[model samples]
Target chain A: MAIRYPNGKKYTPPNSEVKKRSIKDYSYSNRGKTLEDEIDEANDFYLQRQIAVIHKKPVPIQIVKVEYPSRSAAVIREAYFRTPSTTDYNGIYEGYHIDFDAKETESKTSFPLKNVHPHQVEHMTVVAKQRGICFLLIRFSSMERYFVVPLEMLQNAWTRMLTGGRKSISLVEFEEQAIEVKPTYSPRIDYLQAVRKMLP
Target chain B: MAIRYPNGKKYTPPNSEVKKRSIKDYSYSNRGKTLEDEIDEANDFYLQRQIAVIHKKPVPIQIVKVEYPSRSAAVIREAYFRTPSTTDYNGIYEGYHIDFDAKETESKTSFPLKNVHPHQVEHMTVVAKQRGICFLLIRFSSMERYFVVPLEMLQNAWTRMLTGGRKSISLVEFEEQAIEVKPTYSPRIDYLQAVRKMLP
Candidate 1:
């Protein structure tokens, strides 16, 4: 339902097959629900306990046309999905601005750098520079493993790629740089607990 | 354009005239653009200067049906505007979690409580409880006056209304409780400076 690709660069739209494939990028097979669902459940658990307040921002869409059939219900007639400039989820956690993107890959060996866009990387860099808690929740879906990769690690990978380095972060690299988060029943994915461990 | 009213109490959305009236409520006579524009411009100014990273969250919508007529463009055939559960604008400023709602009224003497939904107030209360900087950017368009009312003041007014007190906050109270912000040429409304003054 969300388009992660920047229009001209990675994904040129009007290609039905490619678009369909992009949607598959977000869907998880093992779990009945997606990784987004796990994070949402965790957020809900936190909100209920007043432990933290975080939310996935709405998918940005450019509304071109609206039909006012009746005075009350204005149905959106035409809208185009817009690539988000910032991360998907952000909120206040432990009096700090928390910003992160949740991504999952089918690959067990490496998570492609292309999964995280250039623009999002730029936003995360600015956020981390501002001393906000910025990171990525990456899931190796095949291995059923999740890791919270800090923005510093992401920025380094992104910079290295721009300089003609490897275009993906290896599993071994993730194990060293990122903190692994274990999913639990009540909170689903307790990434915040992992966040606490990472913080000074 | 925007429905500030909650569904049951203030707004019953199948009615056309009330909906049209609500659209008019968002429009302004002077400056042409709404107060939302002023805030957006200010946010842009802040962003350009690297002062803050604040953005308005997208309007929540219940998408009933979408049609992909072409390979690229997916048209929303049927959709309903859902009320936002949280404050619209939020981001990081000097490592602080910033959250706020922008509101403007035609009334010069008072700001109506009916404009703020119970659910939004509940959300704002939780935000303030988390020690995130939370406030309301209220514009009295009739008098060309703007004020940033802290969440504590807003909560007090909301509580008073809920307890059978005045349904609106008087201008006199706003002058005393809220910090007045002057609009400028570049930033449009430099409320962040006002925010800094309010913060401990």
Candidate 2:
């Protein structure tokens, strides 16, 4: 049995150790899907049941050249990825405009601030000012746990990094400020429940 | 002098006659900008002023091949456009969810229903069901007129078309049911003014 801390979070190995475990561990199974996939599945579940209208925004690409083999078919010959200007997922839920991004980190102890872009922070700030529900759905992959952290907490973390404070949010801080979203089989990630709890 | 109809609208020339006027009029002027550009600039104006947070969702692209020459660079080699599953724009305005698509038509008499995609109508229906303020920003290019038509109006038109009715919304119908958005020097679309008027 693995040793656990007083709070019952199992000890996570170092980055090098975790990386080594994947050596010859290329399991091409559904279990290997990324955090993005899980959230997408959850969003799909929400959409089908009419629980919410949230959707992941499509990936933006800048096209430079196109080839028209026929009048009906045009293919992109050259293009580049455009950095998204806003959060990945946004839509209305019970008349509330909800906006958020999903982030995953292998580190169990802290979530790095570098995962979020400055412009995204600015967008979320404006959304929060509009009184819309804005936040980050962060997944601690190593611990197999998720948390719905509010935008205010993220803004504070951003300020801390700029003012030469901690560059990341410690697990203890998250446990204090965030609402844990337990993963389930059907919804995969029942984040809306946490959102409901967050609502006044 | 232009002939005015009963509603004070100037008589529009036939398409052939109107298209003939531009035989040598290849003007590379700001006036030649598309409705998409106008809406984008208007969105920028709104964003800079912190009015309402709305944005155009980017064109979705499907990637087939990419070349990463370096750790920091990725060039897309092959890609194809994917039909968007929702409207072109959506965001929050004064704590209300706003969703819409922009369409421009050369015809001055009617806005063709063929301009709207079936999936887009379905998506907007879901958004409206969720209590989002959804509509279409339609521009009659030749007349330099724009109208903000409610989704319900579009839905009714769609139903009528399917039930052996007109395949388009006549200009008279638009004038009666839709709000005409005056194009201005600043905020070229001034759509939110129309949206504000729309709010109860």
Models 1 onward score TM values of 0.85, 0.85
Candidate 2 has what TM-score?
A: 0.85
Q: What lDDT tens digits, residue by residue, belong to model 1 across residues A73-150?
A: 777766666778899899987787899999988799999988888889888877776778989999886566899998
Tens digits of per-residue lDDT for model 2 on B37-135? Answer: 788888898888888889988777777777777776577777777778989899888888999998878898999999899999999888888889999
After TM-score superposition, the amount by which residue A177's alpha carbon in candidate 2 deviates from its true location, in angstroms, is: 0.7
Residue A140 displacement in candidate 2 (angstroms)? 0.6
Name the 10 consecutive residues with the lowest summed lDDT in model 2 chain A.
A1-10
**lDDT, residue A86, candidate 2:** 96
Put down candidate 1 lDDT per residue, B85-187, tens digits, no spaces. Answer: 8988999898888999888777989999887878778887887788799889998865778999998899999889889999999999999989998765566
Superposition error at B119 for model 2 (Å) = 1.1
lDDT (0 to 1) per candidate: 0.78, 0.80
